[model samples]
Structure formats: C-alpha cells, structure tokens
Target: MPEGHTIHRLAQDYAEAFAGTEVRVTSPQGKFSDAADLLTGGRLTRTDAHGKHLFLGFGPAGHPTPAESIPARPAAPGRAAPGPATAPAPAAQDHDDPDHDDTAPSGWVHIHLGLFGKVAFGPVPAPPPADTVRLRLVNDTAHVDLRGPTTCALITAPEKRAVHDRLGPDPLREDADPGAAHRRISRSRTTVAALLMDQKVIAGVGNVYRAEVLFRHGIDPYRPGRDITPAEWDALWSDLVDLMREGVRANRIDTVRPEHTPEAMGRPPRVDDHGGEVYVYRRAHLPCLLCGTPVRTAGLAARNLFWCPTCQQR
Candidate 1:
C-alpha cells in the first residue's frame, strides 16, 4: 500500500484540484451513491490525511479556510498507482487520528486505499468514468477518480473523531506527539520493526519506511521496542519526519542521503517501480550501499523486512 507520504500528497492534490469549490460528487460504481448525493453540491471545505487515512470535508457553500487553499505544486501527471493487489475493505477501527470537532456542521468522507487501490486526476473534460470508480469529484478546473479504496464512508463529525481518537500520532501532522509513540514503544516487548508498522503504535509508517529508516540508523530489525533508547527513538522519529516530508514533496520515497544518490556515487539510478534510491527495502541480496554487504530480507509482521546484516549489528 502507499505510505503515509502518499496519503498526504493525495490530500494536497485533492485540495489543489477540488477543495473549497462546489464539487460534483458521484459514485459511478453505486457503492457510495447515497453519500455522494448528500455531498454533491457541497463545498470541499477541508482536506486532511493521517497515516493512510484521508478525509474530504463537505459543508454548505461558503468561504473556505485559507489553509485548505494550498498552492499547486508540480506533480506526476494522471494516475497514482501505488500498491499491490486488492484486499478486503478496511475496518474503521484500525487506524487512529486526532478528533475533529464532534459537533461540527460538516461531514467527512473517510478513505483508506488498501493494497491495489488507485487514484487518478485529469482536466475538466473528464472522460467517461470506468464502472469501477468508487468516488469521483468534479469542478470547473479538474476531476479526480477514486477506485478500490479499502474504506470509503460518509461519516459524521463524531465518527471522524472516533477514528482519529483510536490512531497513534501522525508524523506529518503538526499535532503529532512523538512522545506518545515513544511511550508505547518504550513499554512494549514487540520488535521495533513490528511496532513501527503498527498503526496503533505509530501512524503512517509502512514496510518501506520501517525498513529504510532502521537501515539508515544501523538499527537491528530484531531489536525489541523496550531496547530502543529514548535518544535513538528521537533520532528515528526526526528522520522519519524529514524523509516522509521529502517523500511528500517529491511524491516518491527516496530515502538515500545526498551523498548516496546515483549522481554522487556515479551509479545508475534505481530502476524499481517504486522509484526511489535507498540503502535497503526490496534490494534483497544486492550489495549494501554503505558497507557492500549483501542486503538481506526476511518476513516480519507479514511484510518483507530488508537490512544490512553487517551494518545493523545487534
């Protein structure tokens, strides 16, 4: 599935294309038709993302908050195909976020793109939507399509808050509290790798970030969370912020430091579909970028974990 940065990038894309405007909401697939009907003429007043969850706020037509009006940035054209095959729709109970007002007048459309979900954008004269579209938003300037999302529901303000209340802190959000995540991590016997992948423990980290961040810090993936010192946790958290933020800006995960980039090292750019240079993460059996040790991989938390065994000594 797409990482937290991809979700945040989608939030920015949705805001730039349709937020604050009167949107034509529809569910061509008929699954979300009722909610779309209710939101059809409403203005997209706000857009938010926490971890992999996305929210598009709808309310009566009025002035939108300045915050929702982000300046457009150069992004990849058309579709964002970020994950693997389709899976079951997500349960709202899994991911956590901070609560919005429980008494607000507007409603939120929560979306979680499980593996195989995709999002696409286009100009105003959008072509006929495919029968698979779960949601579509149109305005004078652009149109966007959502397909195969794990969770797409029209939720009341309180319901949105409830979802957020259950989630751990999101590093991308200004409101995130690293200490909250540290508290949970410092007390757990679980491997730090598993803890980082747990949404309930730390929002928005996926296999890619979890593996790459650990490799970057030379941390053993098998290290228990309780064994992670506060200073190490702090450094890890701060690196996540920086790397994920760069991911948002570039719309891709490139975790390699400047000196390790292809240009700096006189090496060809990485040729993976994920489109990022990194020390580890899907580079199994390849030489480690730093120590020239063969990168290793194993199953952890149901996802592949990659690291440099020589560098990430326990």
Candidate 2:
C-alpha cells in the first residue's frame, strides 16, 4: 500500500490537475454509476488527504455560495469494501461560515486506494474505459482513472471531518502534533514497531517507514512503546518528519545517509519493487551499510520488519 507521503502527493496532483474545474465524472465499472451521475457536472473545489484516505470537495455549476446539496447514502458495510460514514447536514441557522451558508449540502468524494488500487492520468479525450477502471474524471485538458480502491464514494462534509478525527496526526501534515503520538506511545504496551503502524497512533506510517525509522534511531523494533524514553520518542518523531518529507520530495523511500548510499560505497544502486535504496528494510542477510553486520528480519504486525542486529541492538 502507498504510505502517507504517496497519498499527500496524490492530493497535490489532483488539486493541480482537476480542482476548481468542472469535470465529467463516470463509473466505468458501474459500481459508482449513481455517484458519477450526481457529480457529473460538478466542480471540485479542493482535494485533501488524511493518512491513507483522500477527499475531494465539490460544488454545483459555477459553485454558487450556499448551494444546498445532499450527501450520498453509504453502501452496505458487508459489501465488497468498507467506506466512510455520512455527517448530518449542518443546521439551517448555522451562520458560522459567512462566505457561504455552512448548512448548504455539498458532496465530498472520499477515496482510499487500497494495496492494489492505482490512479492514472492522461490527456483529454480519454481512451475508452479499460475493463478494470472503476471511476474516471475528464475535463477539457486531462482525465484521471481509478481502479481497485478500497473506498470510492461521495460523502457529507461532516463525514469527512469524522474520518479525520478518527485518524492520528500525520507526520507530513503541517499541523500534525507529535505530542499526541508521544502520549499514546507512552501509554501503550504494544511494541513500538506495532505502534508506529497503527493509524490511530500516527497516521500515514507503513511497514517501510516503520522499519527504517526504528533502525535509524538504533531502537529495537521489539521494544514496548511505554519503555521507549521520551527523548527517544522525540528523536523517532523528528526523524519520521524528515524521512517522510524526503519521500514526498523524491517520490521514493531512500533512508541511507550520504556516506552509506550505494554510490558512495561503490555498490550498485539497490533495486526493489518499493523503489529507492533502503538501509535494513528488505536487506535481510545483506551486510549492514554501517557495521558490516548481517541485516535481519522478523514478523511484526503481520509484516516483515528488517533491521541490523548490531546497529539496532539497543
């Protein structure tokens, strides 16, 4: 699955490519046909991301202020995939937002690209929908197709807020509070490795960042969260901000330092499906970049975690 960095990048891409424009929406797979029709001629004003989820806010033609709209009803939970809940309409008397009536019903498209989900963009006159394409959005100059997403639906404004509320602060989010995660970690008995992957503890972190960050801090992945010192937690959070930011900037997960890069060590650039060079992640049995010790791996939180036994022995 793509991590928080990938979701953030996707949000930026969608904002740049389709936001503020009236785009034709369609459900090639027929699953979202009703939603496509409801949003066919609407304009997307903004795109947002929280952890692994994506939200696209829309309004009617010309996007007149206070234009009332209704949130789409949700599909059955037992259906193929789970989705977000709908928020109640803002009260008619609510005047909190002077720019427009806050009660105006509007649509919020929530998208969660699962492990196999993929999004693609191309020029105008998009080609005939591929059989696997679930949804497509086309405007004058470009179009985007989504396939296999764990979630794709039109929800209410409050629904979007509800989703955000359930998630932990994302390291990539400017307003993310590390202290929230610090408190959670300080109270949990779970391994720090497991805690990092928990969305409620820290949104957007995945197996890759989980392993690399722990290795970078010389912290054992098996250490209980409560046992990790506050100083260590601080270091862990700070490193995550730096690493996740670089991942977004370069669109890859390179975790090695200048002196340890494959080029610097006269080794060929590492190759893997996840992209970019990494230190101990997926480098099991390979020599540690720093200590020449064999990198190791083990099952943690149903995923393989890689680390250097010697370097991260602390």
Candidate 3:
C-alpha cells in the first residue's frame, strides 16, 4: 500500500494536470459508469488527499452529488480522503476544508488505492484503457488512469467530512494538531509501533515510517505509547512532518540524516525496490548504519517491523 506522501503527491499531480479544466471522466471497467456519467464534462475544481485516500473535487461549485444525480454506494466506513498534511503554521487553517471555496465540494470522487491499486499519468492521446481502470480523467494536455483501487466512488461533501472525521490528524497538513495525535498516543497502552500504524492514532504513517521514524529517534518499537513522554512525542511528530513532507517533494521516502547518506558513509546508494535510503525499514539482518550491529525484523501491526537492537534499545 502507498504511504501518505504518495497520495499527497498524486493530489498535487492531479491538480496540476487537470484542475479548472473540463475533464472527461470515465470508468472503462464499468464499475464506476453511473457516477462517471454524472461527472463527465465537469470541471475538476480541486484535488485533495488525507492519509491514503484521494479526492477529486468536481465543480462549478454546485454540481449535484452522485447520491442526488444517480444511485451510489453508501460511503465506506472509516474511508479517508487524500491531501497533503500541510506543514505546521497558523495561516493554514483552511487548507483541507471542503468548504474552502465558500461552498461544499459540489461533487467528489473518493479513491483509496489499497495494496494492488496503481495510478499512472501521461500526456494527451491516451491509449485504450486496460478494461481494469476504475477511473480515467482526461483534458487537453494530460490524462491519468486509476486501476484496481479499493475505492472509486462518487461522494458528497458531508460524506467527505465523515471520512476525515474518522481519521487521525496527518502530520503533512499544516492544519494538523500534533496535540490531537499526542493525546491519543499518550493515553494508549498499545505499543508505540502499533499505535503509529493505527490510522486513527496518527494518519499517513505506514510500516516503513513506523520503523524508520522510531529508529531515527532511538525509540524502542516495543515501548508502550503511554510511556512515550510529551517531549518524545513532540520530537516524533516534528520528525514525521519533515520526513513525510520531503517524501512528498522527492516522490520517495528517504529518511536518512545528512551524516548518514550513502556518500557520507562511503557506501553505495540503497538498491531496494522501495526506492529510498531508509535506515531500517527492510534491512532485516543487515548491519545497522550507526552501530554496525545486525538489524532486526519482526511482525508487528500486520507488517514487517525493522530496527537496530543496539541503537534503538529501550
């Protein structure tokens, strides 16, 4: 599954490619045909992402939602919407509000690309879709294809709000209240690693981040969330904001510090398919970057957990 940064990057990409233009929306796979029919020829007014969910806001500011224009599936329970977690700042109050335009989204296409889903973008003259594409949006200069997503539904503004309501605050958004995430994290008896992976505890953090961030801060993965000091949670939240924002900009997750880069360490760049210079995400038994101890891996939160026993000792 893609992390929050990837979804945030896609939101920016979508906005860049088609915002303000009348897009031809289609569901070649036929699953989204009814909603697509209602959305076709509508202008893509905005695009947003929160956690792993993506939202394409179609509007002239008052377009009818699929629920009103066509029969649509009920909003999926606990479904999140995609948008960047803007950096912390007082000026960003309206960053992710659906009503930022002074009115509701009018209509929204909500997408969650689970594990097997993929999105691709290219210049105009799109080829025949693979029949697996759940959604396709095209305008004069570019086209994007959505295939195999766990979600591809048309939703209303209030439904979008419900999705956000169920999610924990995302560090990538400026409007995020680190206090909110800390409140939950500071009270839970769950392992900090498990708590970090919980979408309701802190949105957008996944397995790689859970491992790397804890490793970065030398926090033991098995430590209970309730044991995490206020200062520690503040540092972790700040680090996540920086790392995930850089992930969005670079389009990859590279969590190594300046002194630990491949060049600085006199080592070759990491060669994993995950495409980032992470410290311990998938290193398994490889030597720890800092202490040279063999890294460790275990199952936690239904995903592989990696850490350096020596460096991240409790």
Better of 1 and 2 by TM-score: 1
Pick by TM-score: which candidate is best?
Answer: 1
Error of 3 at 223 (Å): 0.3
The lDDT for every candidate, in the order shown, is 0.82, 0.78, 0.80
lDDT of candidate 3 over 198-229, digit per residue (tens) = 99978889998889999999999999999999
lDDT of 2 by residue, 195-274 (tens): 99999999999999999998888988888899989899889888988887677656678888888887789999888998
Which ranges in model 2 have alpha carbons more than 4 Å from their true place? 64-105
lDDT of 1 by residue, 172-282 (tens): 876789999999999999999999999998899999999999988989999999999999999999999888877887888999988999999999899999998888999
Best to worst by TM-score, what's the order? 1, 3, 2
Note the residue pairs that clash in candidate 1. 96-167, 97-164
Candidate of highest lDDT: 1
Give the lDDT ranking, best first: 1, 3, 2
lDDT of 3 at 153: 93
| TM-score, every prediction | 0.89, 0.87, 0.88
How far does residue 291 in candidate 1 sit from its true spot (Å)?
A: 1.1
